[model samples]
Target: MSSRVQVVEQPGLAPAGLDPDAAYAALAARDRRFDGRIWFGVTSTGVYCRPVCPAQTPKAQNVRFFAAPAAAVSAGFRACRRCRPDSAPGSRHWDHRGDLVGRALRLIADGAIDDGGVAGLARTLHVSERHLHRSLVAEVGAGPLQLAVSRRAQTAKLLVEQTDLSLAEIAFASGFSSVRQFNDVMRREFGIAPSGLRRTPSERIPSADPALVLRLRLRPPYDADALGAFLAARTVAGLEEHVPGRRWTHRRVVPLPTRAAVTEVTVHGDHVVVRSGADVRDTAALVRRVRRWLDLDADPATVDAALGLDPALAPLVGAHPGLRVPTTVDPWETVVRAVVGQQVSVAAAGTLLARLVAAHGTEVAGESGLRAFPRPAAIAALDPAAITGMPGSRARTLVALAAAVADGSVALGSPDLDEVEAALLAIPGAGPWTTGYVRLRALADPDAFPASDLGLRHAAGALGLPEAARALGAHVSAWSPWRSYAAQHLWTSLAPAPVKEPS
Candidate 1:
């Protein structure tokens, strides 16, 4: 379904197109989504990015408008280290294409192009390579490979700007196939040697070779305290820690494929710092996973507006206009968290999670002292006694959950969420509420609603299930692809945060 509103080039702000003068006027608003989508290149400095670039906002005459980073690079502007305009999520224009094109963009970001060639990606998308080629060229001025190449170049830029990784490592990390290819593309894209892209040398960085660490950005009024409080409540024992002040703030390593090492994540303002313990050959791929896990790519203005139909949620909609549901950095951790939360209060589930991590998780040694979340095999290998305090029934369910995950009976990453929900039900003791929660939080499916959740149920009673489903579904269906965010608003709106009672 295409957006009723076409994304006309911001001829300024209105379709008539505003000059640099008017565009800068919008910048003073600190609109983060507009940061990269529009830019002004200073002729003097030869730099251009989103208006929100925190360095120094340039004067009107020095700026220029560009909808695409490739366009900016075409005109000669290196990406800023502080404001990585290249890393912005695909324009929401892609999202509104309720067709093969939209799904293709979503899947491409999920690493389809890097994993396989155009034919393979096209096949997964149920379209011909030729048709896929035409659609991308028609819409974005880049074919699938061109789009993927652009993404790769941006990834290279990030690694060059942030880390000490070699060009060869940076190439593969950025999803390029070879060192020469990486260097060639970087020069083509940025018109400079890859080596010249470095910003500054970090005095102290992680020992992980062939790894690149970068921060993922989001819009402001993010309700970080709410996000932290939410994580602090559900963070499992050894797998994650939100109560901080020790080593890496909120650190826990999740498993990676090549080496059985941990991946740590810490949240800064509007971004999460991912710390890799082992060298990652594909830095772009790693960053994509981190972005998906943190759910950072969501465009909030679109989401907030989509979720604002219901009057009951208007206050939450007002307080934090661009709220996002928390996301899981590791699918494995998501499964474990779901199993722990089954019949327990959020606090109880969190206690069990911490205990589980401490017992089976590996230690990440640093003053940022973190530990890797335990692996599926580790849980499968453990004694029932390790969950000593948990109910025997719950313990059995968890073991069954582990075995399912370990055996590939349930593949976790981006599972057809509905299928996963059905599979969860097939497991003994799992219910609709638990499965729904998993979809809403773990899978990041916007449409997944815990219709049976006490809060949702109460919120819906005024309408009844059929009426509620109709009313709620009708209300949030416009949120379409982002219904999970709408559900988060509905839930958070009723927040019963440990009360001193609102004065």
Candidate 2:
């Protein structure tokens, strides 16, 4: 451990039992494990850096810890250029909490405020704007608006460093209201003018390049092969393509509401590369969705610690240390797939889904060889018999789901998991298994588990564990907040090895 990074252990970091000593120790050791969980701001230098920063650490008395990047900025610190603290994986603490604060953070990351402002976000979460602001301040040391501002600053910084977009364009694209606001925020948060921060032309890639590529950082022990295999098995023919160990491609409406693009996601060693043909304006939103799809924000160390205590799961955890639950880029798309998957094998269900997309999906205009999944309105307008191969009951359920979403009766990406599940169950054919699967994949719920699924039961039996859904459900309750991940491990035990295929 570096002496400059070392600090005496102390217990007074937060009321939530976050130990300052532990945070400092991780910083001293230059441990990447704590990169997102704790950020150290140096009082003397007025800059904050990630725990894994290679630069010499500041003295203990000069160090202050913050739970989030926004909190550190609130205390008058700029981001360290050397370490790029803003790019760390999101804190696992927020991902595991099912409370209002947690959900609010997730929504904020998804650009809810950028799309609708604080009032709209409040409406979606079924809470008052004032209460939401108060809760965020008390829990995370910053209010909703400030959190949104911090997010924009991070996005702007990335653009400045990685792309050759003009300041005006980058400002508007990153959700800033004006070029002046963008410049002011950059100077305030990073202690550098926006133009001064930009790399020389040759050092950065032009935004007009055919593919907009960006690197997504994630925690170690990630089983990329497992995730690739899981998605490849469920991919729809035209809407998605997967070449195991190389890339996964999909076509979707980016930035929510409007822009359309084709995205190719590839997993490298510790980072995933997202290359898209979307407009430069939607890069920030595209990055956010891709991160969710890969579950890159999940904290693997925390997950391993909790699941490793169980004897049955210990070996599996050891085998696949950083296994993550694969999620969808679009909530409606996930719901449609779940409905199609009812009472079918993975391959058969994929075929039916591909047929549905081919019939109703809006084809992309370029050489992307992709089609956007039908919007809720498009699906809601259809007769049940219009979907060729789907069973009458399943088709009706899909239309009902589309109607609910279109009518604002079921908010897909809202922070309220209970409300989403209840709305899903009210549909005619959606049962516990379907609701659980949707929750896990669409809403990104960490604890969602379809314990009654036949595949899960088979995996449990093969592992010499409880074979009954009810019994297995009881046994896995101990894996609360991580049952979704446990289900992945169990399911992977039965899945065949991934093989490369043409894209």
Candidate 3:
């Protein structure tokens, strides 16, 4: 289905448009459905708030609805104090679309612009800087620089409220060039000095252990129990622990001035609380990457609407309303896992991966037993014969993949999905299933489906759908852009017993 709202290039209004009367109605109702996707700037108070803000609603004439927070900010409205609009979950609008704008937004959230600058971002997207800037400004209400600043402001706000770190530390940690720049942006964005936004001492993060506790927001109807079960089944020994109805802990190694941390994630109502040993400097990146790994930003309503149309998927969709395609925090690690998992059960793959980690992965500090997955460089340095418990052919394939990644031949972080797939396919013994799994988990591609997998084939057979991989692919075309979610539902339905309900 197409989007209902259209974009109009009007001055002093958002670039994206909806009927003003309807937007005001949604606000009056305090509609949580539109909370993240829409913001209303109150002319009377000169503040912008989410549609679901609890403060008294302003008169319709005094309100202007924006498709994004940036549009309201660009129009000269500061974030509302009561609502804290920046804390809302990210717009599912970006997650459901696969356009240039959507891809750019995802990359920005991942700190691509912070690491590469606008010029580097454009180069990675295979577009000229002029074209990229113009396109962004026309589609959204801001240019690349403004969007990046807005992102940094959000990060800074979270740090100020949650941590006891000095303003100077928070400044550079949030990617500001200097304390002066940070101070200026804070005033402009929040209309307060950084110190004024500090949390109460009782709420402050513990100073002794020095960890950052932050919330990862998401749309409602999240199936936490299901997600926990999936991760628990695939947990690699010494690298991760998943306790049902409790918490999941995993070690992460972040790129760009490389750092390591162990993250503990627990799902609260409509949000996930994350406790990480990553320094305040790395917390913003860690949170963003973990959100991507869990696929938290996905819009369940949009996905369900699309996939529920199919007779085969309709029941499963209804049963599992918020099923997510589990992804990896590390792209290279996911690729290696996919290769090791080929032609094996989930338990067998976990054992092999645990052995690989014991042999080559670095031991990292954490409350839980934590070990960083072997980096491409470390894996490449190893002798193929040393990677035991796999066929010699598979061992050679793993060695070849590691060397390619280490030497920059098979780039996992490429912006171009086609190029990444092509590079993966070019390597010997990296088959279609392995490549598709990597794309689905590592790249966070929502449309990727490993149609050749035995589980999927069996599921299709039981459902009386096309059983062959090629035929199944053709039949599943209607689930475009959400096939990965559909596959998860199919896999869940294949279990002999009914799947447990969320706690």
Candidate 4:
């Protein structure tokens, strides 16, 4: 983003040149690489915008730069009436960060910071509040509260733009303490009043189909065809469907304060439209989970460039740069899906997973009539024979898997992939492939190499196991923490030809 858009705030802010000419050069070129990290504020127009903004670039002398939307607004620049910086892709740090900061961002995205205070967050992260603040500030150029306040303000802005929600409701739902607080934060972050952000509510998008409609983004070269085919084949009969046009629909039960809900996701180009069939009581949290599940937060250029160098993967990377490693919001759902797929054809596995959900899951309170995926506790307590119907080894495996997850033995979203594998391996029926799948998909581990996976091996054929393993390891090491995404792309190449989209 032109050396971070040449951060030229107050004079003597720093030694960095932050040359206006360089920043203007980047803005005029309309670079997508600067999508989120840096933003441009045109002094003449009294507006700030994303680097990829389609509007005409302002004069270089009339331009300024800010580290964040909040910073820009705090400087008296209003959001660009045209580009709407509030809705731009989130901060880069949010997508790539790990450790206390990453976890804290995830929690904040999920409304933890809103619902729970700093102490609550500290307790959940199992660290002192002081430590949490120190770590966040060190890593993200902002502390947890700054990050969260930004998030809450963004949520409030979105609710204003999209929904018929009252400002006060938006206040609470967006995690503000009061309407006054919401307004203040919005003004501080957006440089616009709450009333200023609103647009007339149009006729609602028809939800005739089973689709959860919302906007979604990924880095370039997204193989919509590849993703569509994969999702279509594996969708559950009753709960999920991937239409021919690359539109995907999957039912998920949304949890709310008053009750839970059944929501569907309709993912199309550039946006994943969510059809709640219920109030978007807390649109922020729902949006956060959708981003996670779709792996929308990944930076593909960084990942593809790293993993694409391998001779074996170079071709696959060439074809599918936008390939994403599918993830789930709930680890229990992920483990169960993995278990259901065991020894079964992909289609059969999807059907069984749906069946298991139907048999055990509670009906969601909202409109779509879908049910929640069974929780770990629910599955753990179920009769193994009733669950499997085939009463043999698979049943035993399912039971063990459920028990382990139910008791926290299998840490699905664990930072420790090895720990997850160890926990899953402890279960009788969980094989190396299943454990690896869980690690790769559920835990989001980049290095979770499933060498035993037939698909991976076949995809790696001619390279030979030792050689494949060595090459893959070396190639993916460059991919580092994002290797899971690389593995997903490789696996996609190996998946049966009549590919379907994710469930």
Q: Per-residue lDDT for 87 in model 2?
A: 78
Q: lDDT (CA) for every model shown?
A: 0.63, 0.80, 0.79, 0.66
Model 3: lowest-lDDT 10 consecutive positions: 1-10
Candidates ranked by lDDT: 2, 3, 4, 1
Encode model 1's per-residue lDDT on 1-503: one tens digit a residue.
11121222323241114455556776656565454346555555665556677777666655656645654554555555456566655444343344676667766766677778789888866779999988765544346776677787877777777777677777877777788898887876655788877766663345464334666665554555555556556666555555443222454555554443355566666666766655555465567666666566666775676566656555667876667677776766777777777666778777777777677778764444556777888887776656776777777777877888888776665325555677778878677777877877676665676665666655545433333544655655555666676567656656655322121
> Which 10 residues in a row give candidate 1 its minimum summed lDDT?
1-10
Q: Work out the TM-score per prediction.
A: 0.72, 0.91, 0.89, 0.81
Global local distance difference test of model 3: 0.79
Per-residue error (Å), model 2, residue 38 = 1.8
* Candidate 1: segments with Cα more than 4 A from true spot: 1-84, 89-99, 126-128, 138-141, 202-213, 243-248, 260-274, 358-371, 377-404, 407-409, 414-431, 458-481, 493-503
Candidate with maximal lDDT: 2
Q: Across residues 1-503, which tens digit of lDDT does each residue of candidate 3 receive?
A: 11122333334534235577777888999876676777888777778898778999889877877766776677677888887898777754665455677767767777788889999888878889898888777667667777888889989988888877788999999999999999988887777788889999788545466667887788778877678777877888877776654444433444324567777788777888777777777766777777887778777876888898998789888887888888878899899988998898889999999998887888776555568888898988878888889998898899999999999999887766667889999999998998988888888888888899889988888888999999998888889878889888888886644345434
> What TM-score would candidate 1 get against the native?
0.72
Per-residue lDDT of model 2, residues 388-491, tens digit only = 77789999999999999999888887677888899999999999999999988888888877999899899888778898989989988999978889988888
Window of ten residues with lowest summed lDDT in model 4: 1-10
Instruction: Report the C-alpha displacement of residue 444, candidate 3, in angstroms.
Output: 0.6
